[model samples]
Target: MPDYKKNSISLTGAVGLGTGVMISAGIFALLGQVAELSGSWFPLIFIIGSIVTAFSAYSYVKMSQEYPSAGGIGMFLVKAYGKGTITASAALMMAVSMIINQSLVARTFGTYTLQLFDGAQTEWLVPLLGVGLIVVSFLINISGNTFIQTFTSIASLIKIIGLSTMAIAGIIVADFAFTIPNKASNPPDIGIVSSVAAIALTILAFKGFTTITNSGEEITKPKKNVGRAITISILVSLSVYLLLAWAVSSNLTLSEIIAAKDYALAEAARPAFGDFGVWFTVILAIIATITGIIASVFAVSRMLAMLTEMKLIPHKHFHMPGSIQKHTLVYTVVLAIVLTVSFDLTRIASIGAILYLVMDIMIHWGVFRHLRKKVNANPFIVVSAIVLDLIVLSAFLWVKFQSDIVVVVVAILMITFIFIGEYAFLRKTSD
Candidate 1:
């Protein structure tokens, strides 16, 4: 049995972990992509995304209140669906989605860091830096929870302050006015479907709250604090995202933001504070992405270890020495590195968004269908989460199919493979 350290994580540290993950590449890397999809009014999507996520969080908060465990979503799934294929597959999907998120943040780290160096060959260096950062995060995580918590807590504080200052300064420089394209000037035609689909990416920005649940077994006052940390993290992220989005829009036009999508934050800085601003933004990005990976890897490995401990997934020592958590840490980093090397940012975010939303829908439905009465959750909120997730997910899929069918296909294949593999494993074990 894995020895989870109870009371090792405090409420503040839990909030650190949550916001640490939320404020990373989610805002720095994805702002422009959301803008591209939603046009000049992209900032509004962050608000809508938060509202949607709040509904989804109701089920998770209720579940955590009832069943706090290191397994997090994995534990929740087993409670709702039992230790069956549905549980295992959905749990695995959540794990994989988190790993996908790590790679996304890692690559974002590379992209933003490279802004400090002009004329550098980025084709290979971006992945190289990303891999290097993931390795460092692995080292930090292995040092134990205390060090990870301290690092994330401090890093989260720095990022929140740095980004907030930058956003506020930029807005002030722009005289608190946004350069929204005039309707008569014929801006990019952003449809309602496109704007709703953009919510998928924005929700990805806030989904880091779920990481708080993964540490429930270690948090002080797991039942009350887990939910509190999640709520606080979401509200904090919403504030930062809104201010930053407005700041970016205030500084740069929609075309410029879309053109510099991958490193939009850095570009947004240039217009407000010149080269110094760009450097500041890059430094903040580096901190945010590094800490983000540390926090994410910390949660993801534990969740996977929990799955292994529950015998929901098969594990191999591979001649590696250490506990199951250590092994899962290695597995998590390797997978993230592979993804960072294989996919570009756009496709990566696409895949993560699709997987996450699908898994989220499963969670809500599970709660509503089986655990609502037991958990004392509102049926309306649970079903509303399901409906909202489905709407955004469908719109996101439609948008992806129209633009990038390959991403849609890859997401579908991944979901199919997970369910099929879990089914085979469970059958073999039962027999």
Candidate 2:
């Protein structure tokens, strides 16, 4: 067994890790998608999303304070459900969702980078760039903890400053007024259902805070700093996301935003700062996506490795390895690459949102039903988290069903497969 590198990550590093994932391609890619669903008032969706995520974070923060471990949510699930199918499947779902996010960010990297080049053939170029990014991130992960922390921290700072500057500048250029330029093709009025559905993506955008919990044991003060890091990261992310939403909405009309949904940030830059602004936004996207993948792969591979140690999941070295962590790193990057090549951004985001929300509900329930007392959690907050997730998830599924039945079907099948497969594995292992 390799050292878990306890006390290796400082609180600042943990915040960097969390915001690295949270601030990444999320704002860059998902803004337009959320706008498409919620219309002109998409920025409000982020506010609502943050409220729901704050409730969800309560379960995780309480759990980490009580039982901090390198295993993170995997450990939390096991404590609540024991070493059973529910524990294994939900943990796997969370792991897969994180990997799905990696692919989404990687693809966003490709999309934003190509904005610098006109008439680039996205058919091959996008996935090619995405795969290249995953490989680079994998190499960075193998360099160990100190470098990863340093790199992500610096990258996080750069993107935050850059994004904040761009957002403020765009808002100023728009003179603090946001209106759809093309009234003829104005977006439809946002309804209750649409607004709720848009929260799913905003939730997904904020979900990066979970990366902090995953690295709980590595932080300097596991019990105290873990919760603090989660809180600070969420608050920071909320501020940045709101600025970004307003900035983009101010610059681009609903139609323009939807058309350039994948590269909306760069598109938003054009009306404000012209080609130079586009270049600046693209550079920031590159930094955010790269650091996002680095931090995510770090936390996710560790979580999966912990599951293997618990024998909750099977593993194979296949004649190559330095440690279980290394093997899992390889596995994590491979899965991300596969998904990057296979799915479009919309499908990837949808699938990730569904998986994450379902797993989030399970975590809240686990704490609410079983560990709430032990962890000293508030029952009202836990129940509110569950209810909010259910509402947003139900709305998201209904909207996807109406527009893209394939995304909903794929999510259901993936959940089914994870649960069924984990049950068989646990049953066989017990036997």
Deviation of model 2 at 83, angstroms = 0.3
Which portions of model 2 show Cα errors greater than 4 Å?
Answer: 178-184
lDDT string, candidate 1, 1-431, tens digits: 35689899999999999999999999988998998898878988999999999999999999999999988999999999999999999999999999999999999998988899878564888888999999999999999989989999999999999999999999999998876733332245578999999999999999999999999999999999999999999999999999999899888878888889999999999988999999999999999999899999999999999999888998999999989999999999999999999999999999999999999999998998899999999999998999999999999999999999999999999999999999999899889
> Which residue pairs clash in candidate 1?
none
lDDT agreement with native, every candidate? 0.93, 0.93
Candidate 1 RMSD to the correct structure: 1.2
Per-model root-mean-square deviation over C-alphas: 1.2, 1.2
TM-score of each: 0.98, 0.98
Report how far off residue 234 is in candidate 2 (Å): 1.0
Q: Write the per-residue lDDT of candidate 2 for residues 271-372, one digit (tens) a residue.
A: 989999999999999999999999999999999999999999989889994889899999999999999999999999999999999999999999999998
